[model samples]
Target: MTFDVKKEEKQFYSAKGPELIKIPSMDFMAIRGTGNPNDEGGAYQRAVQTLYAVAYTIRMSEKAGISLPGYEPYVVSPLEGLWWQDGYAGVDLNKKSDFQWWSMIRLPRFASHEILDWAKNTAAEKKKIDTSDIQWFTYDEGLVVQAMHHGPYATEPETVSEMNDFVSDHELKEDFSTRYHHEVYLSDPRKIAPEKMKTILRHPVKK
Candidate 1:
């Protein structure tokens, strides 16, 4: 059976309250790009396309006789992103056109180094697009305070303030070195209304 990380890894996806979760190290297929996501065919849009090109290549590796141990056909995880700008702890939503972001999709443990390389090469060959910027990233988010934000992405500051209040209440300070700010998009923006979009907001912290 296909191992669905979101369904099996319960703690990673479900959060209705401002709760703290300890997450271990996980590898990701990541690409760093700058500028507004709404820009017409800009870096932000291309980064996402590259991410999926490599992601689907790896997902369909079996067709190429590339078999992996303990592997089963499974759905790809939801799109996730790490947000921040140089020398800034928080991003200015109003200035999204100038925002910098590291867009990534979490790679399962079964996806090995060799498999990732194969996917990169395959994507380049089949799609005839540059996949050089994509790299394997190891992230160890030891302890984080997270909350479920139910609304539009444009109105996320209110939730961030709430998370900050929760963090201070527990005597924990934000750890900027580990990560700037993290978000897991649960709803498809194309299909879901902005008011109904679900995003998991996470902040790295130290006690």
Candidate 2:
């Protein structure tokens, strides 16, 4: 059976309403870019492509005769992002051009720095795109409040507002000092209607 993070770790991916939870440290294959995500063939789009290329390379390593110690077959985690802007408290949906994003996909436990380097080189060779900027890093997102947002990306502010209310009710404060506003894409916009799309909106919080 294939290991699926969504099913295995339901709490992290599936949120019906705003709730507080603790997240542990996890490894990620990440790429950073600044620009409007809607720009055609732009930096954000290219960064996403690079991330997938490397992720798939690591996923299919066994088929390619690449050895990974203690490897297990699993489904790729959903695309996640850390979004923010300089001198801004939270994201401004209207001003996407000034957005700084860290687009990332979670890696399995077996993935290591050495394996990531190999995957980057192999993906670059296969996809004919520069993957040198892709970086391997670990993130520890401690306490957070998250909810499943239902609707288009542009409408996330509504959900964010609700989350903030919950935060205040619980006597917690949003701490963007060492963390960020995070999002996990659970549905592909290409296949799902904007009104029906699902996204997990998360923000770091502290008491």
Candidate 3:
């Protein structure tokens, strides 16, 4: 099912702090890129490709009776981002026309690293259409602040601004190296209107 990039925000949980939270992410894989994303067509294309690959992994895992923590089986798209410039926390669209640096990581919940490694390799094999090189991570603990983003991507600035405010009001500091922009998509773009699509944007901040 194709998910709409814009629309309504779905139900999700997020918090701020230096505490470890239990997140049961379903089985999925991620592809990482480290250059300007827009400049590198391969990066963007592969990012999208990985999504399908991991989605299928979730289906296969369920069929095999493998249960994951926070095992919603739904696609979770959390981005590891860097904001060198002041105020903004995402891709610099204007300068990103050719060489945008970015990476896409997939989160899957499991009891041990053994299954996690297997899942990553399995997803890569299934999605052989794209580059097989990717990374696997078990983000067991970190400070995360998330919120539901309503409306279009163009209007995401407001949501981001609010998130920043929350961080400030709560006396949270940002850890640049570990800072990331996490997103979970629930609406199928092919089936929902742009204004009605929802996306959850989560950013990591130090408490």
Q: Best by lDDT, which number? A: 2
**Candidate with more favorable, higher lDDT: 1 or 2:** 2
Candidate 2 per-residue lDDT over residues 6-103, each given as its tens digit:
99999898999999999999889999889999999999888988998999998999998878887899899999999999999877778999999999
TM-score of each: 0.92, 0.97, 0.59
List, residue by residue over 85-194, the lDDT tens digit for candidate 3: 33555434344433333344444333245555566577767656543454454443255667777766557667778877877887886554644555555455557887
Cα lDDT tens digits, model 1, 1-207, are 887889999799879868888888888999988888888789878988998999988788787787767567877887888887766766666778667788989886678888788789889999999999998988888899999999998889889889989999999988978575889989988899899999999999888
Off by over 4 Å in 1: none
Give the distance in Å from residue 181's predicted Cα in candidate 1 to where it truly belongs.
0.1
Ranking by lDDT: 2, 1, 3
Stretches of candidate 2 above 4 Å error? none
Stretch of 10 with least lDDT, candidate 3: 2-11
TM-score, candidate 2, is: 0.97
CA lDDT of 180 in candidate 3?
50
**What lDDT would candidate 2 get against the real structure?**
0.92
